[model samples]
Target chain A: MTAKIALSDVHKSFGTKAVLRGVNLQVETGQSLVVIGGSGSGKSVMLKSILGLLTPDSGSIKIDGRETVGLARRGRADIDHQVGMLFQNGALFDSLPVWKNVAFRAIQNDGMNESDARDLAVDALKRVELGPELLDLSPAALSGGMHKRVGLARAIASKPEIIFFDEPTTGLDPIMTDVINHLIRNCVQELGSTTVTITHDMTSVRAIADKTALLYKGEIIWQGTTDELEGSDDPFLNQFINGLAHGPIEVEGQKLDSAASPIEAV
Target chain B: MTFLATIGTFFLAFFEQSGRLSVFVGQTLAAMLRPPIYFRIIGQQIIRIGYFSLPVVALTSFFTGGALAIQIYYGGNQFNSEAIVSSIVALGITRELGPVLGGLMVAGRVSAAIAAEIGTMRVTEQIDALTTLSTNPHKYLVAPRVIAATICMPVLALVADIIGIFGGFVVGTQSFGFNAAIYVQRTINFLSVDDVTSGLIKAAVFGFIIAIMGCYNGYYSKGGAQGVGRATTNAVVSASILILAANYLMTALLFSA
Candidate 1:
């Protein structure tokens, strides 16, 4: 079967700093691919490039085999309609009430009536185990965990075919992270949507990922199933998954030899 | 050689800035002319940018009118003081002061508010969310604001003109002891429809400047809270400067004869 999303040799740069350098990725339909990387490893940049929030300097980004690179906002409308994104910090419109924020895509894009949109929002919230009482409340009233839940609700509300989550469990408590991770898995399964989530949280990666990819120095260095991810002795993968201080991973412009002892490398 | 390089760099930067602004203007105009205009958003902005601004614009025009009367009476001889005060006050307020002052005040208030709101939205990635939701930020956010401010400013300036003329009338009749009827007549005789129309035109342009500057600065805001703050300040400063510059250009063009 054709991949639902395919990125090949994607390169993006900001001035002298190259964020995404020759990133190659693929996600089959109904598969959940989680990209694991350190902060500023160009994970977010890659995600943005896929979403058409940023255009790549070179290479092709295809959605359902359609070339999407260099497409203008109007050109990407059909693609955007089938995509949902949950930002790192929820990114809910603080000006809007909770229901409005959840129903924003339905009402604004789909031209659904306000009443029906509210009903859809209620249903989406329920899927995330949220009650109707939070509908009229502002996003400012929600706790951090509640914010992630609401963000997830908004992302899955329209039941788009493709969903992207950016650091979905960052800043949340352990319990909340697990809750969010499980919810993301359940939502993706329910919709049978292709998902590409970017995060460094191991617990989240194990809980949510069907296949995991390791990104380092702006490139995808490793790709495997979660079990493979855990068992693989690849220096980069081993160093990152075990939270090691050394083992061929560059730190502050210094590269640690994989054969060297962790203490000596440090 | 160093001085020449500095001058060359300045000119290049100036041209680059101008080119970017020209592109922005083109995009805004395209967004405005497109379908899905969001009339409800435009209406809300009209109330916010125009109706809410009445008090400030009116008060400024009133005090300005009164001050003009006092100055003209003191400067002129007794015989022509009443006519001179009434006529000059009416002309100045309607043709120049009313629209310019009201525009500047609205720029400070409305421009700053737009910048802060949009800047916060930018830093939070809500704009990106809007795109993901299949909505164009330019169409939904920027264009409605630009349309509303452009439509409301002329009306605001008209109100300012009337209030300002009334202020001059009160000062002329009460303080200068001139006949109220004659003061009103002289003011009416001196003020033509063209004078008011020109100021309204200036007001409309200034309104466009205010909204566009606010939207532009806020749209590109980055970093975080400090970035939002900087965007807000730049919006007000740029809008205010453009208002003054546009006013001069319009005045000279309109009254060149």
Candidate 2:
């Protein structure tokens, strides 16, 4: 299958600190790729680079074979219009109501009618299992789970060809996490959209990721299908997935007790 | 040697920051001229940055006008020249105090609010979210505030000019035993259209200054809450200083003859 999104030798750095040394990754059309990494492992940076929020220092990022790195506002805007992102914290506009927040891209970019946009927003929300009763509610009024649902609704509301979910289950409980994971799976299947998700939650990784990539210290050390992920023998992958502190993954260059309560196993 | 180096570094930082601010202003102006202007955001900002700032601006101008009248009278008492109070107050209110004082007061309120709100958005990734939605933050957020403040400032200054003159009038007639009709006539006669117009011009410029400073600081704010707090302070301080400095330059340019 042709690749919907492709990155080759992507490198980005801020000042002296290098975030992405050389991240070469490719997502096939209609594949869900989850990138799992530690706190400072450049997962967010990689996502931001693709979104054009942060420019890479070097390398090629191709969406449908068009090089996207360093694209100007107009050029990047055309790409952004076809892409939808669900931020780690929902990132809903507090100034707008739930409907307006969901229909933001439609009303703001396409100049769609407000009534029509709201109708579209309601349809998207319903797909996320949210009823029309929450349309008027503010983002702050919703619980963490509800917020993620609304965010999912907004992300898919525009019917984008590519959707990104950044740590979709960071703060949700187990049941809600499963709910979000299920929603993501259904959304991708229904739309047949290429999906990229960055998350550390193993349960989510299994539920959502068709293919899995492990990013550590600005490099994708291991990538394979979810079934293959279990049989992989990469030390970095083992330490991260099993929450082992003593593996090759050094914390700030200091070796810690491998037997200690592993950091952020969730 | 260390102190000398420190002084050199400080000057270099100052110039660098000033240069950055100049570029930011140019970008804001360019974005404003481009299409896809969000009229709704502009209206909301007008209410937030201009209309909401009315009470504070009015209060400061009123008090300053009355105080100016009192000070002018005291200074003129020695020469039995207190009659100049009405003329001078009207001139000062229309030409300088109206725009300058109004600008400063609004700068404190509007600049801080804009900085805090936008800075929060920046930290929370809402600004980046705007980009992902195909909306330029400059066009959607910054331009609207700048345009709203620019359009609203002259209007705010006009209101301040009237209220300030009235404050002076109240003090002159009631507090200083001046004839009300004579004071009103003198204020009307002494104040030329050019004087009010120049002040309004300054007001518009000041409005642009406030919005630019606020947006620049907030947009560039890093870190988290502490960074946002710093941006809020810098916005008020820089906008206030720029207003005072620009007022002097504009006054020289307008009335040098």
Candidate 3:
């Protein structure tokens, strides 16, 4: 299968602080790839670089077989029209009502009439299981879970072929996170859209990701199917999955207390 | 030695910041007149930046004009030449104080608000969200504000000019022993279209500068809440300084002939 998105040797830095260092990844068409990483592990930066928000110091980013690294504003807009993003925070426009926020891409970018855009917005919101009454309310009025659902509705309003979800379930309750995960799965399945989700939520990875890649420090250190992650005996994967305080990965400035404990038979 | 170095570093940083501000202003001007006007957003901002600001600008000008009449009377009384009160008040209000003070007042009120709003949006990832949705933040946010301010400030200045002249007339007639009819006539006689037009033109430029500075500072804001606060402060301070400085420059240019 041809890759829907591809990145090779991506490198980026903010002043003297390096973020992404020779990172590489690929996503096949209609596949969902979840990038798991710690905070500040450059996952967001990678997604932004793909979106042309930041020009990488060096790399090749290809979307649908076309190089997208250095696209101009018009070119970037052309690509942007084909892609949708769900930001970590809902990031809805506070000045606009929920319907307007959902239909923003349709009205502003696609040039749809107001009535048509509102209708589409209501339809999209309904798809995310939001009530029609919520459409007139401002996004500031919505709960955190509801806001994410509205953000999701907006992301899919254009029926884009590609979607990027950044930390989709970071701050939600477990039940709400599950609902979002289910919604994400169903949306991708229904639309047959390729997706890249960046999250630290392992549950979300298991629920939504077709493939899982572990980003460490600035590079993808391990990548395999979700089953592989569950079954793998890799020390890094073991330490992270098991949630052990004492392991190969050290939390800075903290002593490994278990290391001082007596050796116990496993 | 370290104190001297710190002073040098501060100047260097100031120049660097000034250079960046210039670039942002240039970009704003370039993007302002481009196609695909967002009329809805511009109308919304006109209401926010101009109509909502009317009370403050009007109040400021009225009091300033009343004060000027008193001051001019006291100064002129020294030479028994209080006859020029109406002419001086008319000239001062229409030619200088109306536009400059009105612009400064609006800048303090509107520019800081715009900067804080946009800066908060920037830090919250909302601006990035706009880009991902294929909405140009410049076209969607900044251009509308700049256009609204540019169009509305002159209207505000016109109201200010009228109110200011009325204030002077009231003060002159009541406190300074000038006949109401004579004071109004003398004020009208001293004022020309060129004087009013010059003030209006300066108001327009000041409005543009204020909005542009606010939007630019907010758009590039980083870090977090502290960063947004700094952006808001910079927006108000810079817009105020630029408005005052530009007022003088435009006055010099307009009056040179």
Q: What digit string (tens of lDDT, one per residue) describes model 2 on residues B112-137?
A: 98999999999988998888998889
Candidate 1 per-residue C-alpha lDDT over A153-212 given as tens digits, one digit per residue, 9 for 90 to 100:
999998999999999999999999989998998999899999999998999999989999
Model 3 CA lDDT for position A1: 56
TM-score per candidate, chains pooled = 0.96, 0.96, 0.96
lDDT of 2 by residue, A17-132 (tens): 99999999999989999999888999999999988888999999999888998889787777888899999999999899999999999999888998899899999999899999
Model number with the top DockQ: 2
Off by over 4 Å in 2: A257-266, B4-12
Which scores better on TM-score, 2 or 3? 2
Collision pairs in model 1: none
Tens digit per residue, CA lDDT, model 1, B1-257: 99999999999988987898788888999999998889989999999999999999999999889988888888876566546888999899999999999999999999999999999999999999999999989998899999999999999999999999888888888887989988888988888999999999999999999999999989889989999999999999999999999999999999996
lDDT of 3 by residue, A60-175 (tens): 99998889888886776777888989998889988899999999988887789989988999899888998789989998889999999999999998899999999999899999
Model 2 pairs whose backbones collide: A246-A258
Residue A60 lDDT in candidate 1: 96
- Poorest 10 consecutive residues of model 1 chain A by lDDT? A251-260
